[model samples]
Every structure is written in C-alpha cells, then in structure tokens.
Target: MKLSPYFHDLRSAYQAELDDLTQDSEGKDVLRKRLAEKRKEIAFLVQMMELAPEMVAVVFHQGFRFARPMALEQLLGRGVDDLPGWSSLSADGAVVLEPWAASLAKAVLAEPGGERFLAVAAGLEFMQAHSRLAPVASHAEAEEDDGDEDAPEHDDDYDALSADDAADPHNARSREEASDNWLSDVGFDRKD
Candidate 1:
C-alpha cells in the first residue's frame, strides 16, 4: 500500500488520538466513556474536521465496517482535493457505520461539510489499520522518490502510507504545532 502524503500524516495523528482515548491514568480501558464524551462535543469537533481531523475523527473510532477496502485503498492514494465525494463510497457500498455507532454517524453527517469529513475519516482509519497490521518491508513503506526507477510502476492500486516515508516533516511539524497550540488554548496539556 502506498499512501499520499496527506493520508500519511493524518494516520499518525489519528492513531495518537485513538491511543489517548484508549486508557486513563488507571490503565483500565475507558475508550467507551471517552468516546461518548467526545460524541457530546461533536458540534465543537465538527469545526475541527478540516484543521485537526484526527481529533474530530476519533468520534468515529470503530464506527466503520469496511465492505470494500479496495475502494478505500484506492482513495488513500489521492490528496484531499482529489478525493472522491462521500457519496461515491456510500453508493458503492465501500463502507457503512456499525450498528452501534449509527447515532454518532448521523450526528456527524448532519453537520456542514459532514460528507467531506467522513471521507477523510475513512482514509485515516484505513491507513492506521494497514500500518499497524502489515509487516514492515521496504516495499510496504511509502515511497519517497516518486522518480525512482525501481519504484513499482503501479501502486497495486491499494492506498495506505507508512510513517517511515509518507510525509513532509515541515508540514507534519506545523500540523503538530497547531494542534498543540489549540489544545493549550483549550485548557488541555500540550503533548510533549
């Protein structure tokens, strides 16, 4: 799987958001409670969809049931602007909300730009899953040299990018900084 740089960076942020929501100081699982709390904040979070997507996207953690990973894989290769509309995925049955998460899905979909956010949310989860589940081989990582002769001519049409080579550090750093500053302003401790 090869990820476009946009998906690559968002995956890392998405994974981190999920991890933070996974546990509390006691180390016992609190994901459910945390997610519920986040769901309550959907209106505020909806505003974050474009700027801090991973933060907003956590509301849909485990919310998707991927019926057509192939469709999602194809999506991962493109940048945000080139992404297909959400209807394309829904019409093709590429993904659907899990029964338990339907209400949250409804809430998000009801928001302005909800369709766009859902598409980005799916891409983040797809890349995160493939990154964690797949074994690391040089070939499996995101290719840095688009012009390398040895680079596979075809991406196998599967879209997922690994952190190893899937990003522009400057962009990632700026994103991180923006996220941190936002958190600080919102009264949360900045990530170290």
Candidate 2:
C-alpha cells in the first residue's frame, strides 16, 4: 500500500531523530534513553497533529530533505490516490524501507492524517518497548570468542531460558522493574 507524503515525511523525521539520538552515544543504555526521548517527542508531535492536522507541516530539515514543498502540498491536496507507485520522497531519498518499517508506515497511512500521526507515535512507543540493543563485540573479543573451542554451546539453553522467562511472572515483573528504572533514568514516568 502506498503511503501519503505526510506519512513518509513523518517516518523520515522519526527515523532521523532516532539516528541522531544514537549517533554520538557512548557507554551502555544510551539507546534506551534516546528511545525514550524519541517516544516523548513523537507523542507530542502526534498530539499536535491531532489538534491541527492541516497546520502540521510534518516537514523535517525543511522541504529539501523529503518531498519538495510544492510536492508535499500537492500530495496533501490530492491524497494518496494521485500518487500510485510513488514512494521515493524521504530524507534518505529511498523508495523502500525495511519490511517492518514499511508495514508500520502503511498501517499508519491507512488512517486519516491525525490518526495516522497517532498511529506512528504508537508504533514508536511499541518499538521502544520491545527493542533491545545487541552488544557490539570488539574485533579482539570476536577473535577470542572464535578461538575458544571449549566454550559451551548454549543456543538451546538460551531458547529454553527465554521460554521459561516468558512463562514466569517473577521474571516478567523483574523485566518491568528494569524497564521502569530505565525510563526513570531517562526522565520519563512509567505508564500505568
């Protein structure tokens, strides 16, 4: 499904914000903080969109980045129907995103402007809630691990542990506590 230009612009802005937040990070848990801030910003933008969809430009980095100013107005006026097979209007100038991102964009655009923005915000929140950063191994560490033939293979154990964790209320509560602590560290109140 084709997305409206507004949705495309919002997506680009959302991703850019995330990228910017993660670009200069150092130490662990940085992504969690940035994700929290991004969620808050998105929530505010969505609220603004809901209050005044027409007034919200949804433009990031001016019109030069995503759709041209005229093109954006034209798309807004004409709606998605006028732009079949038209997709390449993002800050990255890419017509396609990761399948998951594309699906989220399509879902958001399925709604009207304000609702679409809200959907985007909800999507961000969902992403923030579920995302876990993988540890980046240094080259030396990678080489060391590769050479460790005696290391126990724990793939099955990991799978079983995750399954057990999913079924355990104590584990779930611990995860929630960790999440709450992270949120608080990032200056956000845990949503009840």
Candidate 3:
C-alpha cells in the first residue's frame, strides 16, 4: 500500500486520535459518546479540514467504506494540492458513508475545502482498514536520514494501536499494575 507522505503521516495521528477517544481514565469504553460529541462540533471542526484533517476526520471514523480500492490507493499518492474533489469520488459511489454519516457529511460539504478533505478522510480510512498505519519511512525521508545519523528511526507514537487494546480492562489493568510495581522499584511510592 503505497502511501503519500501526507496520508502516511496522518494515519498514525488519526489512529491515535481514535485511540484517545476509545477509553477514559477509568478505562471505560467511551468511543460512542465521544464520537457523538465530535459529530456535534463538525461546524467548528470544519475550519481544520485541510490543515489538520486527521483531527477533524475522527468524526467520520467508521463512517467511510471505500468501494474502489485502486482509486483510493491512487488518491493516496497525490499531494494535498493535487487531491481529487469529494464530488467526483462520491459521484462514482466509490466512497460510501455509513447511514449515520449523511448530515455530518453535508455539514462538511458546505465548507470551503470540504471536498478535498473528504477524499483525504477516505484515504486515511482505507489505510486504516488495511492495517497499513504502521510507520514506513518514505523514500525521501529515508534519504534525508542517511545524511544525519542522529535522527530517530521511529516516531514516538503510542503502540501503533495499543489504543485498541486499551478497550480491554484486563490489558489496561495489567499495564497499570506493571507501571505501579516499576515505580515502587524506582523508589517512588505507587500512585494509590
């Protein structure tokens, strides 16, 4: 799955954003409630359509179902300025929305850069469904790294998807307990 640097970069951020919404402090599954809240804020979030599509795109998580894999893969190769308009993609019925996404899509369509952002949103979703969100250094980035040997090999993204595991109380509790024991060994009192 060849990804444009744009989609590649946003993939992790979008996943992380969803992961953030997936659980609360008590490790309860709060995704539905949080996503609903985000949907209501679509009007405000539209402002970030192009600048930070991943942040705004979360409102549409599970909202897109791409019918044409090739088209989406092609779309991922284009730079931001070169993206196809949403009208074309939707016209072909290549990007289908979940039944619940209609009004939110309409709200987004009314914005200036909304169409392009939708295509971006779809590409992000496509990458996500295919499990292509893992970090892969692009050709240019790899070359740039060779000159500076001190650069970090990876982005410090939280687990590519521990956010998914966070939904399980068992995983979250074990992790919490492990952290407490580690802290105790380090001479700090366990956090109650």
Candidate 4:
C-alpha cells in the first residue's frame, strides 16, 4: 500500500522535532527519558488496542521503568502534585506552551477541519505501521488457524459450489447452498 506524500512529510517533521529535543543542553537527560517513556506508552496503547493481554504485562513494565516521575499519576503517587509547576512540561526552546488549564482550553476550543483531520489520521496510520502495530500473521500461524479444531469446519459441498460459483458468476444458488446445505436443500442440483 502506498502512503500519501503528506504522511511522509509529517513523519519526517516529527522526527526532526524529536531530534531537536534531544539536542538541548539543560534538559537533554529529561527529554531523552521522556522519549523512552513515550515509546513505551505508545507501545502499551497499541497492545491495548489489539486486545493482546499476553503483551500487556511486558509493555506495562517498560511504561513505568523510568527513573523520574514521568507521568501525572506517578507524581501524584509521590505526593508531589501540589508543588508549583509540578505538572508542567518544561522544554528548552522558543516554543511558548500554555499551562495545563490553558492547554485544555485551547484543545477544547480548537476544531480540526477536514484536511487537518485527514492529515492526523494518515499520520497515525503511518506511525502505527512504523511502530510495527500493523498485524502480520506468519504463513505457519495462518495454516494453524485453518487446522485448529475451534475453527469452523469447511462444508462438504464447498469444493463443488466454489468451482461452480467461479465459473458461473450469475449462479442462482444461495451462499448457504454452496456449503453443507447443498446436499440437504430441496432444489440444489448435484453435478455428481
């Protein structure tokens, strides 16, 4: 599948911003730590979206494995939430960010128009693909699913009906008659 040029640009821009964050002197350590934490959070979110319980435990460990309190919940746990600017995200740059209250207001007030929404959606898909969240089942695993007893058994008449269906696109046989029901149905014609 081909990705839009806009998505490619968005990805490159995000990477450049991340690189800029890593190059700062005063908060270089902090930014690097946050970057690692962000990766784990994204991974955890992906696992949750996939409903993969087996991978959750592993991802959760990485999510909170940072040295400093990287999240609001973490700071609250240590009773450090009351401190001035405790919840503030400090970044070294010309970027003038709003406080949490202002940020929330800004976010609530902003409306993403059609093009912006599409860009965001495409960027998310690109990120998920790059992060390896795109589901990829091996040939062996796919074969195992077909062999698994839990999978529904292929009806006996499937072979004949499939052949007929392929040859005659306008065949009047209902999809159900193309399966085991073919032998049981009253009007079904058996070529045998």
Candidate 5:
C-alpha cells in the first residue's frame, strides 16, 4: 500500500535504528536493549494505529515476501480501491518466515490494523528474537594473522583458544541476526 511521506520516513528511520544497533565496537549485536527502548518510544504510535488504521500509513520493512514480486508491484501501482484486503494480501505475501516473526505477524494481524502493526511489531520482534553476540576479531589481528600464514608451525595453544572461543557463551549469533539473515536469504533486504 502507498504510505504517506511521514510513514515512509518513519520506516527508514526504523530500519536505520536497527542497522545501528546490529554492531558495536565489539561487533556484538546490542539490539535487545535498543529495541525495548524503541518499542516504548513507538507505543503511542502503535496504539494510534490500532485505533485508526485508515489514518495511519503503516509500512513494514521486509515484513512480507511475495511469491510473485511483479504481482505485488502491480498491486502497489493501482489505486487503493483496487487493492486487496488484508487476508488476500497476507496470504499472497506470506512466505517461510522465522518462527518468532511468524508468531508476531499472526498476533499483530489479529488486532486492529494488524496489517500495519505487522510492519512495526514484526521488525522489533524479529530483532529481539535473532540478535547475537560474538568476539569480533580486530583488523590488526586479522592482518597479523594473514601475514603469519607462511609459518608452518601450528600452535596447540592457539587451537585450544579457538575451541574455547567456540564454546564461549558470549560468542554467538543473536536470534535477531538469524531472523534478519532468514529474511535476506528469502530475497528481502534486511535494511528495507
């Protein structure tokens, strides 16, 4: 559906916020805390949409995937009166989404302006469900390691450290990133 410039801008800001949260100095996903803060910030907007869907321009970023991209484009190109209802849209747009995201979408679509809410809630829920934390190798460390590739001597201590790093609790992908990657794998741009 065509959204107002305000809503479009809001969507862009929302995606940018998520992108910013995806990485830290440690290259860890710090999205959970940030997403909670964002949910609070937009709580009122979500409420407003629930009360008045027609008045709000709800936009979802990579919220749904179309089996036929051209069909979706054609639908968008037409007038609102010609547009299909939420059920048709949802059915047509539905694809294999991550479990958390699928649940969130189902919940949001059950409410007023659920279609619109899908855009906001699905993103936050996806992020909350998929973000990860891992020890990021620094550029200097990577360069040093690259230069040492010629050394045939293998350090058992280094191998042990690598094994330890794999088992480290902090070194893992967040649920949000996994969900985001799923969307990307399905042909939707994460930032979109």
Candidate 6:
C-alpha cells in the first residue's frame, strides 16, 4: 500500500506545530533547520519502504534543504517531469487533515524539505500540553475578597504576615499565605 498519505499527514501536522512554536526570524530559521532534518529522515524511510513515485522519492532523498514539505509537493505538482500521479485516497486523506495541514503548508512553503519534521512534532505536543493547564472558576473566587468600599485604608502599625502565616478561623490568611494556600487548596502546582 502506498504510504504517501500518512507521510503527507505527518508532514502537514509537523508544519502546523512548527508555525505555532516559532515566533521570530531566528525561531523560523531554527524551525526550518529542523524541517530539513525531518525531510531527510522521511526520505530514508521512503527508500527503506521502497515506495514508488520514484521522482518524488528521489526529490525527497536528494534533499530540499530547509524547504517545507507542502511546498515541495506543490513544486512537484508544477514542474517535476516524472512525478507520480497522486491517488484519490491520498487526496481524501489530505481533506481529513486539512485544518492542521494548512498551517503546516504555510510554514514549509519556501524552504527545501530536508529535516524539519521532528521540530514540528515537538511544537505540536507543546501546544497541546499548554492548552490543558487552564484554571477554573472556584480558583478565581479564591483570588479576590469582597469588601465595603467606604472603609478607609488602614494606617495601623500592623506589619504584613511573613511566609509562615496560616489561614485563620475566619477563612482568611495574610496575602502571601493566602496565595500559597489558594494554590494548594486548588490542587495546582504554583509552578505550573
């Protein structure tokens, strides 16, 4: 069975991840370098798999050097003389991965497709993990205290509680202790 669609899906996903990770020109450069590395690895995988579409396979092995995977496909679609015909199945797969694939296509459009896939995957995982850390409503409530607005600011000589302050019977704590207590109460690591 032709595995080009899997390769395409993988490549497309990587690019999408890379785009989300890299924010500046240096980051772009780093991401492109990674893409080139992935492309080379992919080329080797294709060769070992002994897939057809020899020219596409050849372009992959020969190295596109910092190019994006999607652009390479487009270039083949445009100018390659011995390109293999894309199967309808691959086209259908592309449609399924279209949302993520578009971002991947944008990231790798200009450079050669040599070794960038690994970086893409890392970026993808980071985005997914970051999305899972959002806090909840109960935690939000713990961060604020309702007070009478007309009360004058206290000018008493009371010093702020130090780090060891604990919650009092009134369910209140010194500000520093309160923050720590709130975080612990919510079962979330302060560092997260």
Give each model a TM-score: 0.71, 0.26, 0.69, 0.25, 0.37, 0.19
lDDT (tens digit, per residue) of candidate 4 on 9-30: 3333333333334445664445
Off by over 4 Å in 4: 32-129, 132-192
User: Predictions ranked by TM-score, top down?
Assistant: 1, 3, 5, 2, 4, 6
Mind sharing the TM-score for model 2? 0.26
Candidate 2 lDDT, 88-147, residue by residue in tens: 334434222334344334443554563334333432322222222112223334466687
lDDT of 6 by residue, 1-192 (tens): 012333433332333334333345443446455545554454244332222222122212212132233433332223223332222213433212224333333333233431233222222232222222323322343344235455434311112222233235332323334445444654757643
The CA-based lDDT of model 4 is what?
Answer: 0.31
How many clashing residue pairs appear in each of the predictions shown? Answer: 0, 0, 0, 0, 12, 18
Question: Candidate 1's error at 107, in angstroms?
Answer: 2.4
Candidate 4 clash pair list? none
* Best candidate, TM-score: 1
Worst 10 residues of 1 by lDDT: 156-165
Evaluate residue 78 in candidate 6 and report its C-alpha lDDT on the 0 to 100 scale. 30
**Candidate with better lDDT, 1 vs 6:** 1
Which runs in model 1 stand beyond 4 Å of their true positions? 136-149, 152-192
Candidate 1, overall lDDT?
Answer: 0.74
Residue 37 of model 1, lDDT score: 95
Answer with 4 or 6, whichever has the higher lDDT.
6
lDDT of each: 0.74, 0.38, 0.76, 0.31, 0.42, 0.32
Over the stretch 1-192, how does candidate 1's per-residue lDDT look in tens digits?
A: 567878776766676677678879998999999999998988778877777888998888777878998899888888888888677888889987778767766777887777878888877776665554554443455445455778776554333345663476775575567657656865889778
Cα-based lDDT at residue 98, candidate 5: 41
Most accurate candidate by lDDT: 3
Clashes of 3: 0
